[model samples]
Target: MTATARPAEKPAMPHFSSGPCAKRPGWSVEALKGAAVGRSHRAKVGKTKLAQAIDLTRDVLQVPADWRIGIVPASDTGAVEMAMWSLLGERPLDLLAWESFGSGWVTDALKQLKLKDAREIKAGYGKLPDLSAVNFDHDVVFTWNGTTSGVRVPNGDFIPADREGLTICDATSAAFAQRLPFDKLDVVTFSWQKVLGGEAAHGMLILSPRAVERLETYKPAWPLPKIFRLTSGGKLIEGIFKGETINTPSMLAVEDYIDALQWAKSVGGLDGLVARADANTKAIADFVAKVDFLDFLAEVPETRSNTSVCLTFKDPAVASLDDAGQQAFVKAFTGFLEKEGVAYDIAGYRDAPPGLRIWCGATVETADVEALMPWLAFAFEKTKTEMAQAA
Candidate 1:
């Protein structure tokens, strides 16, 4: 195949990173000029801003009124780890893992927490564990979306409504862009830097009434750190849910989040956010359908992620390469695109299969994704020629 001509137009914003994703449409530093800098987060104005962030999160996510939502430290990882350390030892746990992040939780449960009864239900990249095999009688830990592998749980139907245990979900990549069934999830965690395109360093933890009950009734055998403590004297510290953070917070990042939340609301909130991501993924799907070598890493369309869209080369020549060779190829492929200023951070995750990963979250414009398709084809053809000439 002959190499194609350079694309006439490029994406206006070339930020396609999976984390610290693209900023909301029309976002600017000017939007955060009102950040309450130099003021104590505990003070009236700072506290008001903090409370507003929490309130806006709840409203935009459509969280249940009774659910406790708090802004915690250490982004989504911290939130998920905190939930695991605080809640898992009390029951037999079932940990489902399909990708790096989910597998990390499994290791935390069995090695770090050393829970004797914890069972790992696992699948390789691009597939999901059997949801029917999950025991709802035991506490469950899973990721709503596998950011590395580009697979996601299909829906909440797998979770039994009248379960005997809690469901703790790491929804860092799924929230805002996906329909999360709050009633099915006991604890949900996400970072500010994901679908909403806000700054990092903080995580939002949402707790159903059942999760709170577990917190008050059951305490872990290990000592809890001040940062991870959700309860004191076996009583839920209700203030945290009301914007009283455990430690000082970045007011600037909080302000950025507020701006993103406002943008989310302006775009019709959750429904609109989901629609934008859906459109972005659809554009990529169309592109993949026309291209012979590129295909989704996710074998099942139903489980394919709309946010972190992962792709692999289908050509037997490229697919026949060893792991290191494939990695080198992807590195060169991504570097080629970067050099052209067509994309950035589109490399597949280090732990994932060799391929490309693109962020198609709500903040990414569909027109930009559409414009990017031709460039990908051009890059592939050009890269293939370079590899052949070298051989």
Candidate 2:
């Protein structure tokens, strides 16, 4: 008698981690294998491909003609640091903090650079610090989207056009998924591992004309590292933005980024990408509306993010559980989904209140997310059962 074979396990549900988020459906290993590897990034072929990537990005994003784009060392963090270290001392500064990444910038300003006069406006996770109180007369720094908290500045209309201060925006998770008004921005930085869904380890720095002027005329008192140097002897190194990277890059990663950009262009550019992200957010929104135990972390609809959507349990029934018990329930629920191959990495950030943080970026499909909702209900039921047994 032949033994019966075991049933095949279902493939894992689409991953929703905020950083290094899901890739486009149908992305393949064969395409990645074709990427240039073990090749000198300074070679003519490498430079040519890099230039093409920049040009394609400009066209797709509809970047202004005068703006410059550079491939800088480090991910988004490195790119932001380069701008802060190089251009901040020219004027008084206003730093805004609502979440972890924003808080990191404030720390750099206070402790690392030791800028005494900088004004800091901060709020806890899941909320935005008041933007109305900001004095635009001082150099302004903020994240276009708070990846950790799922709050984002809705638009650039809040920025005064005639304001004398330059605006620096950290837009790593927002670049491909949201509408960014370049006219109101001075320095913008992002990385490939975000909405674009490519390799990490490199950052893109986009500079407006006003930012270039600052580099040429105003010099910071701080020492410039080779990676952050944008000028030499009061003259701008214009070629760096045209694909002459400051140091060696991973050519394979460059090619992977190019593949993602090409995919972006093929999918109808920025508008199409934004629509995909919006649909994913809507999926989560609909689910939250019907679930009595869940609610969005973002207090206002206008401020809700289309990319990272965070959720928290709101049922008073669960409130009876102590903090440790609540955490244990969350862990057990997420753990059940992982074992069932329904989702991965849905845990909240350590610094934030206990909840789930899901990436609804462009690369994630709404259908996959829809399929996982029932599984979430199943997991939650399992948690309640486990908790009662423990009690």
Candidate 3:
């Protein structure tokens, strides 16, 4: 094969993509120096940092006194899976899925575990599953926020307090941006690469006392992996809830998470973070209101997400185009924005419908989101022009 030439230089502009979202202000070189590198995670310094992280999370989130937080293996996915494999065998499961992530959990329950009696409630991308019809007697699994569809559960009011089952929630994008009622939640999971804007590879799992009891009492019929085994021989491993992680962790990533947490504290804690996310979402809402063709993918304002905002065009701008044409147009539009350095990685998920998905998390400023709107308009206009010319 012929050798490929390297690029002479890199592009310069702000990047605003979801998932590995934009970093906090001044998070480049200066931030790296403060990170604890070349150190064992089991060292005293590493343990101290990990403990500080847990404390800060508790402080910012205002978690209950009895609840416990720990760093879990992998990212948010691992945390959720660990909970599923460890504590979900005793009761019938109600898996609610309205979007991609929740659907993934359903797949795990049906295909992976082959659970014959798992009740699956589903809806379209922008809508929520019917919670009123859910059985409170069974264990529940759900994603608090649908990142791909930009929809979220309005609150925990739908959950019944007297229910016998546990509620396991995947709150990766909703952790810092929205309110989560710990009292109603049994197992909550989130990742560092979400609303807090930290590096990936680590997940935080918060367990209520009920979840712990489930882990200690009931064992799954399936074989358990070493990392997912929170209980051994009918005993809760209390040390895991402390600074003791199951496997060796990247100290550098841990330090990065600390930096993000410190940044979260400096900005006035969880309330401030929520306000920032709200402001960004309002900016997009206002823009969407004025635009003729653009509409939010979320069905209702109350259920809309403040972090990931998905949009779809309503006009006949590219309706007549074939699937290939639509794909080409989307590629060109995203490519234009990327090359212009106005935005990065704003493309909708491949499995979802054709649209644009923007990250409006806490770390992203409202001013930056506002600044990018006109560029989106510019890209849309260019794409339309190209499509009309092709016609």
Off by over 4 Å in 1: none
lDDT of 3 by residue, 196-288 (tens): 888888899999999988887787899998998887679887777777889887777787888888898898899999999999899989988
lDDT of each: 0.94, 0.85, 0.85
For candidate 2, the TM-score is: 0.95
Q: What root-mean-square deviation over C-alphas does model 1 reach?
A: 0.7
Model 1 Cα lDDT, one tens digit per residue, 1-391: 5668888999988889999899998888999899999999999998899999999998999999999999999999999998999888888999999999999999999999999998999999999999999999999999999999999999999999999999999999999999999999999999999999999999999999999999999989998899999998889999999989998999999999999999999999999999999999999999999989899999999999999999999888789989998888888889998998899999999999999999999999999999999999888888887888887
The reply for model 3, stretches above 4 Å from the true place, is 1-13, 320-323
Ranking of all predicted structures according to lDDT, beginning with the best and ending with the worst = 1, 3, 2
Estimate, for each residue in 255-282, the C-alpha lDDT of model 2 and write its tens digit. 8888888898888899999999999899
Error of 3 at 374 (Å): 1.0
Instruction: Show the lowest summed lDDT stretch of 10 residues, model 1.
Output: 1-10
TM-scores for candidates 1 onward, in order: 0.99, 0.95, 0.95
- Show pairs that collide, candidate 1: none
